[model samples]
Target: MKKTFLKIGLLFAIVGLLAGCKDPSSEAPQSEGPSVSTTGESISEPEVVLTDEEHNIAVNYIARSVPLVIERTGSTIPTNVFRADAEPPLPIPELKYGNDLILITYGELKYEDEINGVYLYPEYTVTYSYLEGENYASFEFAVDDKGDDYAIPDYPRYDAEYDSGGNPIHTVPPAKAARLYATIHIGERSTRFNIDMILHPQEIIYEFTLDEARAQPMGKIVKVYGYFNGYFADWNNGVICDGDVALGLFKINDYREYMQIGKLYEVIGQYTVYHGLPQLQWIKRVTEVAAADHPTIAAPEAIVVNANDFAEQLDIGNELSGPLKHKVGTTVILNFPLRYKKMLDRDGNPVEPGSLELGKHADVVLTGKDGNNFEFEVKLSLNYHMGIDDQAAFRDFFVANPTADIYFTGPLGAYDAITLAPFAFEGSLSLTPPVV
Candidate 1:
């Protein structure tokens, strides 16, 4: 894994800091207004999906229902205690509640994917506060004890779990869902909010089955988990996974390096179309999860086919148009004798050593039994996509032994179906010398 946890690992320290500041006052504050219930009962029916207008109204109501504390900061009301670093801070009314309990101004609607469906919830910012003067409390936020003064509090920071007596306690739930509740304490007084979240089954692409993913609606957010079956082109960032269902990943840079061939991971991104193929775009998160065992990556199934079948699969125009097109992005071995053809750059020119450009593709062809040929492109920059220089050693060995059988394994370039074209990338090319 490419250190996906390295950055997230730092979040634990922030959790520890919040845990140490537990409310010490024995007398909890008396909550005024409609008290939130902790009873484990559904406010809405199971599988109820909220419409966009209803979701807006519900979110506004929840934000307004939360308590707000007013304090004098030079007669200016700042929205929240946590402020981003800026020069000569401007005047804004500070709105907060009991001992920096909750940040109402920064309320945001968030989603969580669960076994049943996608759950919606609200996220509020929490800060550290202390008694100041006779009746007021002062607050400060930070990235750490160093008092950076611009730290953002982590989500689900408020307690949502229950104790043995059924009293609401602070703890992260196993799965963050839409219809969840949070009970926060301001001094001795604790208040609970029963949040009925919006349900969007279609928006949650991670919940898609293999068949569902293929036909999922476009223009939605996806938070799905699957085994990292490595990448497509070594050029741009792309990942292939199979689990809960088979899916593809794209435009995820932060956690791409950590992705391994067989490790399980939860990826969050926007669902969109790329090059006529369905893929997750603008990936927000790529988190590793524990799986029973590494997923078994099956080798590409070899096949014997006539020229027409090969051409139809290699043709991009027919991709995803029907089942007749080859399966793109799948590994396939071509047993046909593929000559050592020249590599061409994006403009279709011969790419000499160091002449290869980034973001451009190189094409290679393989002739079939019917005297027909198929061509495929490889992005020269991607480590997975090998260049002529990369094959110098292997090419030399082939020169010393002309009749040796060679094999290559890699995903096809066509956006839809698997193709038998050779993409000389790393771990895709091999030469088994003739048996003695």
Candidate 2:
């Protein structure tokens, strides 16, 4: 007999739990069954117990949203820093918010020592929708981190103004509560719902290995680890090249600064095939795991091809090269050199001193070993900040020697699927031939 795990939620929607918070003074309400969204429809009418895997899914969704809440509440720490505490050693959040039908659980920041006289602000307030049939809801809030955990930057800590019981007395007023707002989307409909800061559920998250993730169907949301090899700021995108395979992130936020080439990261997103290449779209989170440098990736056995070979394949509309489609992301070396083309000005005339701006476009003529030639488009590096000195040297070298056997090394990209015409990324170019 074969056993299957529960599939995650829809394409971009998050998951939610079956609990809610009520007025603390009143008795707790018993839940009749699993939650029903604002649409008044339930996936299953009978009360369904969540499986272990389902529980992990639900908890992780909540965990991902917590940082947003914390940030909105005015916490100075970054979301990644806060999330790092969600694991063991740091106790999981156990506080509950709403009633049974709509439950929200979270952990509180533990204070190291009690204060005698200092005034303290409330940690934070969250406003989240209680959507039916979902494990989590999208939330919105503002952040202002003062000094000492609160967004409040300045306020000297003085001695105790405590009573005989050793309770601290406040010199300043407590922080104001945040205004709450809630809106929920269920299926094709949208409606208003209630939100409460509730108790924390048992924290759990299932980490997937790369192999396990690759086996899942396309568009499945999963968490996996990899090292960043490429990033495109123009597209607000990046790639995680991990152990012979690479995954693309369509939108990278917060972690953009940390996504230097060769840095390790753990990312969460939906896997989908985009233009014959697998990409992780709707990227929810990217966590930097390692800042240590990784070795430069060497080209795999690239079947060297000439301009004639490329043209023949294009003419026949078939891959004359070995698995060029599979080599969509891997590095392939072109054996021949390319003749440089001057940059064109606005009036369509070639510039003599030639502007070498970052992300500027240039072209070259590929000269095959057998004398075949084809124009090849080349883009300057997006990460021009890596080495200004190197860029200047290369620019000068390019200007001085236009026919210095220009070498191209980079992850191959295709704009037209049929033509399969590839371009060289700026990160993968090397004009200075390797020292013999």
Candidate that scores best on TM-score: 1
Model 2 has how many clashing residue pairs?
36
- Each candidate's lDDT (Cα)? 0.40, 0.40
Over 1-436, each residue of candidate 1 has an lDDT whose tens digit, in order, gives: 5455743453443333322333335422222222222343322222445656445444444334433332222222222221112245432222221112222222334555477565665333323233222112223332323222221211222322333233434433221112112343322233343222111111213455333555655545556666665553342445454522345566554664687766677776656555555566666677787765434433223233333554455554534564323244444444433444444555557655344454444443333333444454222222334444544533343345444445545454433334333334456555642221
TM-score of 1: 0.43
Alpha-carbon RMSD, candidate 2: 20.9
Model 2 residue runs over 4 Å out of place are 1-220, 232-235, 272-278, 288-322, 341-397, 417-436
Worst 10 residues of 1 by lDDT: 195-204
| Count of residue pairs whose backbone atoms collide, per candidate | 28, 36
| Model 2 Cα lDDT, one tens digit per residue, 139-216 | 222132221111111111222233323243534221111111222222232222333222322212235655465555
